[model samples]
Target chain A: MTKPTGPSRRTFLKTTAAATLAAPTIVSPSIFAKGDTPAPSDRVVVGSIGVGDLGRRHHLNNKLLVNPRIQVAAVCDVDRNHRDLAANDVLTKSGKMPGVYKDFRDLCDRKDIDAVFVVTPDHWHALVSIYAMETGKDVYCEKPLTLNIEEGKKMVEVARRYGAVFQTGSQQRSEGPFRQAVELIRNGKIGKVQRVDTYIGNIDAGKWQAPITPPPELDWNFWLGPAPYADYFPNRCHYQFRWFSDYSGGKMTDWGAHHNDITQWALEKDQSGPVKVRCEQAQFAPDGPHDVALEFDIAYTYADGVELHCHSQGKNGIKFTGTDGWVFVSRSQKEFDAHDKALLTWQAGDNDVNLPRTETKHPHHDNFLDCIASRQRPICDVEIGHRSATVCHLGNIAIRLGRELQWDPAKEEFVGDDQANQLVGKPMRAPWHL
Target chain B: MATVTELAGDLCSGDQVKTYQAQQALARLSGEIGASGKEAEKAEAAKALAAVLAGVKPAKDNRGEATVDSIKSVNSANELCRALSLLAGEAEVAVLAECLKNIDLRETARWCLARMTCQGAADALVEAYKTATGTEYRVGLINALGRKQGSNVLETLKLAAADKEPEVALAAVEALANTPDAALDAVISSVESGSSSRRAARVARARVRLGSTLLRAGDDAGAKKVFTAVAGADVDEAPKKAAAAAVGG
Candidate 1:
């Protein structure tokens, strides 16, 4: 594909329209008509991979399909039912039927598509996104950004090496409350942040179920791509995959991806991470299908001596306490609170540190699209997402080893701990790798 | 703090807390000895762990005759292996290699071999890969070789890349993708042009990786040439697009 010269297509079109008013013969007036569909050349063609629950409902229906700037040209899923449903949803919404495929590689291979949305399970995220980026497509992948520390590092390396536009779906970065909380903390509204507490809840282990033949529409082997081979149990696939260690890190990575991400942003540690992590307490279910930690309390110590605590109990939110006061934020009705009520209404002055703000209805997706056109980094770029996800992975590693780990943030390795380092990158099953 | 002998005994105590504490203490001692530049002490500690490993009997629950003692012995053996992963060197390679053949201890043994920086570890894995009969076991050895990438294992991987079993071939191809060696380029290129869809996907990924490797080495023209070739090839679209993107940028 040829790169657009100078201004982006959208910007050029806007400039052309402004000039057309002054010099009436430059371009056709019909091209600038409001509500007209963007020409094929101007549209950001996208392929949707892993179009399951979040892929179809949240990303496609709620965001990409409705965004006038994007065109969903293809959809892929391991389960035929999901791809077909997604194809129908696209047809119904846009009056155009997208190419549906069972394999993500086919979708990634399409030269016509400029980008892809990766909403697969955590295990599949790195491979799919890396492949998409390798094929020269920008990626908007769901969080947590990777299944392990090494995958995150590889993702960042590939993104930078390819210069691909990457947006990790840590939408909390785009939410008003989260953005406000981060801005307040950064601007010293809470003084110097000494500690942060995040509660992201927990998950119960999955009971062992007898293996059964997979459904005809579902390619169970493909669904378990990269993960270790296991017999097909219904609960092991789809939404329940989160509870299994082979597929995910359970709630530590699931809910931790959100709240901990906010904590990272508030503490201005998006690009870096804590120097040490300790699992204060942890409990796992009896040997069953699911082996992820069911309850845990993890603590992280930054190089600057700031402490961040993550727990499986208490209100589901983040609290930042500084020397002067504290600010609590969550997605609930009590979105923002502070020791001093006046801090909530305080506005940034000319000298205060200010982060990017998104006023669009779908702020995160809008930010991604905007960055795609502008060739600028999104709010949750690959590196930022990787670092935030590292926090979650480190916690899980500590709990699994039942020991505290000293982390070297720069080298992205455990300090003299080979066993802990082994968990950094797992051996992928045959045929799949980063 | 317990002496190395005391910790070694506790490691086999079969008590969960004691075994855990012993594992932690041994790891800490290994780290401290490593820091203090005491190679002899580290080797001696590793020997003690290996000795403990050999003495611990295998759990014989296959016949539904598992006893508390047998279970404890198995747990103790596993815990000793975990410690060896942190402390083992060339001195412990033989014992660890022996453990690689035991079904129960193979994982922990492979875990240790994968992390060992010693040349013996790589040699042991390559030897195991050659004689291993089980497909899954061979795949595991191939993975360890991939992590222990060097000139030593490249030939082994190239041979495995042509294995009759598709799973083994694919794993070898995936492992070879990380290695940007000129020797393996022909093999990967041939696979890219081959009939297998899964193998071809890996080759496409490898080609793109080669292009990136060229770009990183400041061979811009060479990188662009590679990108252009991949883009024009009839391979999977993802790698083609990636090549095109590299050239376009």
Candidate 2:
């Protein structure tokens, strides 16, 4: 579905004001208005799929549970402890018990749930999000969107087919500074774009640990889901899973999904990708729990003649260098700046381009809810998410194959490399095929 | 998990779930078996697959709900074909080539034939491409041959590159692009001297993209050469300008 050409601020305010009179449950015109919580009917009913580590800290605790605009209706995770903790946390805050589900499928089947925040391991993203969408639920799937290129394609197809509102969890798209940076670049605040340099953290060269029995709280098989089967190793699950090829694409996709995503948005290349990808240098462990690139310097060439250089050595953010100036933004640094400091402070003239803006402090989930109401594509639409993730996946594939690849962005395939095409759609373990 | 033999037996099972699981397991094991350490072991695995295919026949049983049952059957056949494709030999290729007639199995059968290591694989596909009447099937076969990994397959792709069907020609041209230095030159020649404006446009786009990639990688001279070539071609203005931009015109 196309991105919604949302109403102007004045029209949105007027429409919401009228809507508030007809439905007292509508939140006030000021989203962060302090007076009162919106009526229960006005709240977006959200369920959370994974409640472990980052999911709990960022989405469940900080956003879903605390946000008055959302009512946490259910919590699902393979781990009973994490699910129970999340449900309890919601209960304490809202004084209402959320349904606890062992299987995310059961959570999706709930009629009370309007949307789901899919924070599962990378392998489960497509399955949970697609199923939820098919069941008439909107999805806020965590990035990187899918385990393979095929999965992402299927996800985009199913979401559109079902008319589902989807928002990928590349939350940077919602941040004010990122939007401002992209706007500046899009408006040519930096003269004709030269190159984008992105730095994701170095890969963790982990060795395959001896197999250990899974803890009682974890349903290991369910967690593995569509990925190939492997014996249990604690580090190969949860937050540490990012380093493994089986479950994740290492830090390249982990952080790359975020920074590389912003780079695509700034370049206005979200619908397309680089025509060529080459991994200049990389080191992979001989055998391991992780087989991703330990160090990498990959280069991509877009059809428009712009270069996107990705590496592990540079600052852990994105640098957009244009002929006039360059802007650098890093999440960890909690700062964004430009070569000419004045560029950061530059204001757009009346004719200058301005991207859709969101309310200050409005978390990404709010954007998902807003789109659900508006029936529009979110800031990080499924197609946008897939394209960005494709960039990261291409880099990983190049490094692993130790060759430069000619990519047909229109076809979304390696020009003629049968071997590389084989890696594009990974074979799922039985009963889990897409 | 069932052994390959056990799963192969279950392939003929009446229960749909068992059959599905068996198909998946066999397909997975075939890839492993094809790559097994011992050559004799690999050959035996391929033979076992041939035996399985010889006995298995496509069921024409039309349930009232054709969509659901057919979808299930197509999916199962897809997995079965995948298993056989990974391990097919000369004998297996013949069996898979025969499967190309079955509408539900044709795509997967062609895919299997392409990936088979049998010496006859490419020849079998070229023969099939000649006899195949359906445009989609011919296109599939052309793509399969295009993906083959040798110089021996280039002549067949070159012939298909001149096919009357634009789709067929485009597929062959795409395959030519995949070949290292030699075949790419052939593709450029075909496009440069060819009469099809559409095919020429496609080739020019790829050529300009190559130039753009070269420029991005800091190879100014290489980029300039690619851009210079395409800039003079009968391409749309967009690619010409893109080429000039790559050369800083």
In the order shown, the candidates' DockQ scores are 0.17, 0.02
Separately for all candidates shown, the number of backbone clashes (residues 3 or more apart, or on different chains) is 2, 2
Whole-model lDDT per candidate: 0.79, 0.72
Tell me the tens digit of each residue's lDDT in model 2 across A110-171. Answer: 76788899999898898888768756688999999977787898788667545677899998
RMSD (CA, Å), each prediction? 7.4, 16.0
lDDT of 1 at A71: 88
Write the residue-wise lDDT of candidate 1 on B1-249 in tens digits: 677778988877845446545655665576456543477887888887888777766667573675655556555665676677666889899998887776656655775687677889999999888777777777877877878766769889888888877667767766776664444556656652356664676677777777776677676776777678778888776677677888889
Fill in the DockQ of model 2: 0.02
Weakest ten-residue segment in model 1 chain A by summed lDDT: A24-33
Best by DockQ: 1
Q: Over 4 Å off in model 2, which ranges? A: A1-36, A332-335, B1-249
RMSD of 1: 7.4
Model 1 docking category: incorrect
Instruction: Give the Å shift of residue B178 in candidate 2.
Output: 28
